[model samples]
Target chain A: MFEKLDPLLHSQLRLAVMSLLVGVKEAEFNYIKEKTGATAGNLSVQLNKLKDADYISITKEIVGSYPRTTCKVLPKGRKAFSEYVNALSSYIHPNGNE
Target chain B: MNDAQKQLEMIHEMMNKSQREFQSASFYYLFWGWLVFISALVHYLLLTQTNFTHPYAVWATMPIAGIISGIYAAKQQKSSKVKTYIDEAIGSLWLIVAFAFFGLIAMAPALGIDKVYPFLILLYGIGTATTGKITGFKLLYISGLLTFPLAVASAYMNFDNQLLVLALAIFISYIIPGHLLKKKELQMANSDA
Candidate 1:
């Protein structure tokens, strides 16, 4: 039997975002879009999904007359990501239990 | 391969990409390195050759350098979309160095100028070595490691020669590293373009 992966992080764009955030302090929305090659609407929607899951925090602030949306991985998100990786490894080496 | 394994591979790829982008912060290193190099060189020259009463007047360059660096940092921050943990850690480390420098300067009268260079060298070692470890840059690590002996050597020297040693230390630990960082940044930028 394989370990279960977190559905929230199993998607392509969301997983990409999480992977990026895991190593960074925080990142702006535009940066995520640039890195992931996701459309603004798609990235925004995916970010909302992760935010709703309590895996990430989204902050909106005005800087120099521009509204900036920055995203950071929460502790919960880090935990989930760790577990997800563990589960992934299990599947990758399921028969290596010898 | 199953879905989970595929996702894991994707995660690794994305993480690597982000890390690569974060390693291009050569401007800050170059700016401070050159500023300190020039300031220390001039300070040493003034002490040895000029009749200037306060050789310390040369340190006025620090605030001016700080102002230019501040403007550059703010502009970089405004333009940068990504902020990495490594970037934040290095930035915080330098900030602490700045405050510690001010503290040392304030206490210089009591500690005496002869004792100052050793401490400054030690601090440089710590700053550069840790930065090297964080960024996986080997040259920086070597530079940082060299400062330890240099600091110890400066401790036994007279004030004037101590100044010369300090300049030499800065050249190894900062100026060389700064230029290497700039070269790396340019290569990365060109590759990207």
Candidate 2:
């Protein structure tokens, strides 16, 4: 049996954001937007959803008079994402190959 | 798809998306590396061909511009799925700066301007290797290793002609490795899909 994947990150956009965040320490708003090709409105909504789950932490500040929002993957997010990958791998490989 | 299946599919999709982004980033950096080398070569050639001695032209400005562009790329790469760009850029910059420092110091000893070129070549090669290590890119390491003999051989060339060594190093190291990493990343992404 496999562990369940988190529902919050199951959505395409949210999952994309989290997936990108997983490999990084933190990402700025524009950085996420450019990579995912997600509109600001949509990304903002998806990020808020992740924040609600406590999977990611968002910090807002001003850089040269412009607001900068940076998102970081929390410990919970890392654990959940790892478990999710493991659970999914079982489906593809059927057995632990590695 | 059932809820479980749907979630699994979603996860898979995300993984694939991330892979694609990584692939693109690898190629992007590779292109920039080539551009930097080629531009420097042009500068060197112009200096040799014509009567121009803008001290900052080949020596100071080129590498500084390359480093600045690299930093920008890394900052923008913050959103990339695998963080490959930022890692590569950081590693490359670290090695490049170190090499430049040593190369500058070595230039003064009449160690011959010729000997210094090999150091520059090695710096770029090591930079590629470090980038590869950070990103788990096998090709980068291969490129780094391949450049070793070429860098050594270039030591025998005249100082004026040594910039060719820099060009060759970039082609073998950063350019090829960058492309290889991108290819691997794309394959991985497609596999996930």
Tell me chain A's TM-score in each of the predictions. Answer: 0.95, 0.91
Model 1 chain B weakest 10-residue run by lDDT: B20-29
As for candidate 1, its clashing pairs are: none
User: Compared with the true structure, what per-residue lDDT tens digits does model 1 show for residues B1-193?
Assistant: 4777678878998898788666456676677777777778788889899999898887888898899888988888876778887888888998998888888888889999888878887888889988898888999989999999999999999888887877888888888998898888888879866
Q: Per-model C-alpha lDDT, please?
A: 0.86, 0.69
lDDT of 2: 0.69
Tens digits of lDDT, candidate 1, A47-72 = 99999999999999988999999999
What would the TM-score be for candidate 1 when compared with the true structure?
0.91
lDDT of 2 by residue, A12-55 (tens): 78877887787665677887887778999999999998898889
lDDT of 2 at B18: 45
